[model samples]
Target: MQLLEERILKDGIVKPGNVLKVDSFLNHQMDIEFINELGKEFKRRFADAPITKILTIEASGIGIACLVAQYFHVPVVFAKKAQSLNLDGEMFTSKVESFTHKKVYDVILSKKFLGPEDHVLLIDDFLANGCALMGLIDIVNKSRATLEGAGIVIEKGFQEGGKKIRDMGVRLESLAIVDSMTDDSLTFRPNN
Candidate 1:
């Protein structure tokens, strides 16, 4: 986690509108080694949980989730932002708002991948307003799958997302939680 925080400080860019762009390493153009380190850390954090599968939203979350799945020895299931012809079965659907994109999407996942017998660990690139995570949680509940926890790469601690998720009684693990960020400086939550 320290590695992640240091990387953020060195490479992350602070944009206007409270945006922290980590395109260099965390999300857009990925650092495989660093992502693998994150996967290891996530595994360590949720070591006690019986994680049967890793659930994530498509796009940014897929890469990190796949790496994390390798450590958990589980398959990664991502909710698609757009419905495709290839998908033709009963599906769980939920509406999610993107903090970065500033749009809402109907995320969907096949019912075959998740069920009551399995325990799920949700993974994502970032958590700001909790919309995406909440959508994934909705799908998990619809499928009757056990929600183990969520592993986030970066969490904006100034935002209410973390608190909302925690209030719902879902365990959340974040690699680096930024309590505050500006164009010139960034501060992380103490004891993260």
Candidate 2:
């Protein structure tokens, strides 16, 4: 986690409106080595949990989830932000509002991917308002799968999303938690 905090300080940019644009290493030009480290850390943290599957939202979450799945040796399932023409038949859908994009997405996952016997680990790039996480949790509930836990790359600690999910009694882990972000500076919560 210290490595991630260093990376955030070195490469993460704080934009206006509390948006920490990590396009330098995380959001855009990804550092594969760093991602692998995160994957390893996630595996270590959730070692006791029976992670049968890894669930994530489309786009940014996919890369981190895929990398993390390697350590878990589990299939990664991502909730698509857009329903494609190839997608049809039964699906579990939830409405999610994106704080970054300022838009609503009908996040969905195919029923075939999740089931009662699986333990789902939800992953995401960022946790701000918790809407996306809640939507994924809803899908897992619909699948009747056991919600194992969640792992995140970065979390906006000033926001309420992470707290809400934790209050729901889910074990959530974020590699780097940003306690505050201004137009030019960023602050991270020290992970004990």
**Lowest summed-lDDT stretch of 10 residues in model 1?**
183-192
Weakest ten-residue segment in model 2 by summed lDDT: 24-33
Q: Specify the highest-lDDT model's number.
A: 1
Which stretches of candidate 1 lie above 4 Å from their native place?
none
Error of 2 at 129 (Å): 0.5
- Residues 1-105, candidate 1, lDDT per residue (tens digit)? 899999999999999999999999978899998899999999999999999999999899999999989999999999999888998899999998888788989
Model 1: lDDT to the true structure: 0.94
Q: Give the CA lDDT, 0 to 100, for residue 141 in model 1.
A: 98
RMSD of 2: 1.0
lDDT of candidate 1 at residue 91, scale 0 to 100:
92
lDDT of 2: 0.91
Give per-residue CA lDDT, model 2, range 91-141, as digits (tens).
999999989889998998999999999999999889999999999999999
lDDT of 2 at 119: 97
Give each model's clash number: 0, 0
